[model samples]
Target: MGQRTVIPFGPQHPVLPEPVHLDLIIEDEKVIEAIPQLGFVHRGLEKLVQKKDYTAFVAVTERICGICSFGHSLGYSQTIEVLMSIEVPRRAEFLRVIWHELSRVHSHLLWLGLLADGFGYENLFMQCWRLRERVLDIFEATTGGRVILSACNVGGVNQDIFDEDLRGIVRVLDGMRGEFGELSKTFFRDRSVQNRLGGVGYLSKEEAQDLCIVGPFARASGVEEDIRSYGYGGYSALASFEPITSKRGDGYARCEVRAREVLQSMDIIAELVDKIPDTPLMTSVKGAPGADSIAVSRLEQPRGECFYYAKGNGTKYLERFRIRTPTSQNIAGMTKTLQGCDLADVPLNVLTIDPCISCTER
Candidate 1:
């Protein structure tokens, strides 16, 4: 047997943009085990539920992470809406779907770029981010912020995208399709990318289900679990929605799943814009939450499933607010995948699950 060596992967590493630290125990070049260290960037955003009123905490939740900000905002707002029994308008629902899907597109594009960079494909990385700029531009044009979109509220969305604006967004998405298709070919067919990712980080379908993995990570393993299929927000109106899945259960499969999701999100947005009704954007929110009321909201975030729980005490402030981020749930699976893999593949394997340390710890 080869002598064992212990290595510290990162609180900061070139491949990972977040502050996830891993202790890898290896025999020669093969990793025998991995232990994760979290909480380096915990912001205590969930703890602010007591300090801020339910209405004001939506913005607080939005600051969980820049990449998944909209998902956090939506989950928190949806929880508050349930607590208050706010009937979010159809137009508002549709608008929420539009922004949500656009955020998904934006997130997937960013991840693809990061994944490309992880594989040392700099040109591919640049191309992916260049396409992502269009999505961010749409965010700025519609909601006034590219990252922390303070557009969602308790009852509904704060901004109303006009027909002209919707058309413009559509134009931008359409323009990217060809270029994105070309970029996807590189990811799917390039020998270097395939060599780096294709069979690494294998998670079988049963293993994924047993770990209760969420989002594309699970879907890549052929587990057809997507919280969006439960029909929240504007997703209920889209009859054609289906969770994308791949049977390969490896790093390449994970990449393929997200790459396809970007296109799927575009289609969903088109469906939403075509059917979005012209009506009031925001509904008036009145009264404090009912005493002893508890609200829970779950949705398919860009990462996976995200959960928000809120408890009321008959006052302006919520008694408790809790979040369950997908990365937290997937960490065990990540650790399991790390066992018996080459040390060199560790970063790419970890990136396959797409950890958001801030969101996970917050």
Candidate 2:
């Protein structure tokens, strides 16, 4: 073997969205081993539960990640609802699902843009973000905030959209769908994109499962596990919903999974709007959770399955709160994908997993 050399991969990079450092060991221009260093921007958001109380903490959870902000808020609220035995109303559930799916579409669009930029496809990158702005506009129109939406609460959603607004949302999605097709064609058929993504960063199904990878990473590897299938937030109403998967388990497979998921999200939003009941947007949640009660909730976020745990001691405050983001769980898989790849492709493999360092460190 050639003499090994160590090189730091991140904490700051042109393509990465958040700060995550990697100590890469390379020999003759190929990575021999890869190690990750986290906590560069650890915000300790979970610890704020002790000071904010259960009802007030929903706002804090929404700030954990901008791309998946609504998902985090929904997860935290659902956990509290479970602990307090509050039954969320049917209409609220449907509305929550609508917002959650919109968030997913926004996140995937952002990822697709980043992926295009990673391989120097700057035109495609610009096209993807340009389309993504329509999704953000829908968010701002409904929730009054494009990124950090404070729309979910412990019992239900904080706001409601009229039937007219829902119809407008569908129109926006229709326009987006048309524009997205033109952009995605470049991702699927362009020679340059295929050359950079196809057959690169391969991960076997067994390796993905062993690493406990979640979200699109696991699905792209054919794991067939999507937490949305468990039926939280009106997902159960869509009986035919199935997790998207590809057996190839490579960078191309990952990109395909996310691309298809964006289309699927549009379908889901339309279905929810059609079936949404005309009832109150939120239910009253009273009293604190029972003493020593513990609740755990899982939801399929844009990145992957996000797990939330909340414990109560019958006081005004929560005893403990914990979050396990998908990026944190996929670090092992990241290391596996890094080995034996060219040094230049390191960022491509890393971005393919769609790492959200803020979510991981929070």
Candidate 3:
């Protein structure tokens, strides 16, 4: 019989930048069971929506998670758009798709860097972040903020892109593509990274579907579910977009899924730059008509699918607002996937789930 032991993995850890806490029950060096604790960063952002007008509520939504700020704001705006029956211009929708994919690329790059750092591949970590900086530069150039763009508004977006700016973005992405390819090969083909991540903490397709997993986590497990396919944003007009999927449902598979998606995002952005139509960027959003109107909206964020529900009264302020982030829905599956994995594989396993505590707690 093996000796049993319990180890606390986080609340505060140098390797994990996020504040998620996990307790691992181990038999020797293998994990037997895993438990997760959340709510360490809760600030009740959902409840604050009732105090602000529908337009002002965008600020609160953007703060749901720093990494997913754009997606959060986009989701909130879409919900309000639905509630108010606003017809967003085609150009604005395409712009939304551009920024959305750009945000996705930046986010996946950040995760890849963190994953590399977890495995002690400091150079690889730096390389991934170096490429990610170009995406941030594009964000700052267009939206005025690197991390939290806060460019989404209720009727449409708050910013516009010019022809010169679009050309600059395309050039930067072209440069990033070459660098991304090299770094991806180094990470995926390296024996050390493969040994640490490949086939580690696997979840079967059935388990993933049964648990209602979202985003890359589910896509890696062979779930062909993507919110973009619903044509909520400008995705309906994306001529060459495809959802990235893998059947392995393991840590390495998740990494591959995100890496491939990053390339796809670049492709989407390039396509948009070539075809961006000239139109008005903003539509004025007036007050809500009644106090009981409600609408639900969902978006395919980089992490996963984020859902927002907004209810308004016959005033400037909303009556209630609710958000269900991808991380919150995937925590159960993440813990289940961690069981029976090697202790050394803990960081990769947790990261494969892309646990965003800020989104989960909020």
TM-scores of the candidates are 0.99, 0.99, 0.97
lDDT of 3 by residue, 111-153 (tens): 9999899878999999999888988989998989998898889
Clash list (residue pairs), candidate 3:
290-313, 290-314, 291-313, 291-314
- Pairing residues by index, what is the TM-score of model 2? 0.99
Off by over 4 Å in 1: none
lDDT of 2 at 224: 95
lDDT per residue (tens digit) for residues 262-326 in model 2 = 99999999988888888777789888888999999998999999898999999989999999999
- Residue 51, model 3: lDDT of 71
Number of clashes recorded per candidate: 0, 1, 4
For each candidate, what is the lDDT? 0.90, 0.91, 0.87
Best-first order by lDDT: 2, 1, 3
Local error of candidate 1 at 17, Å? 0.6
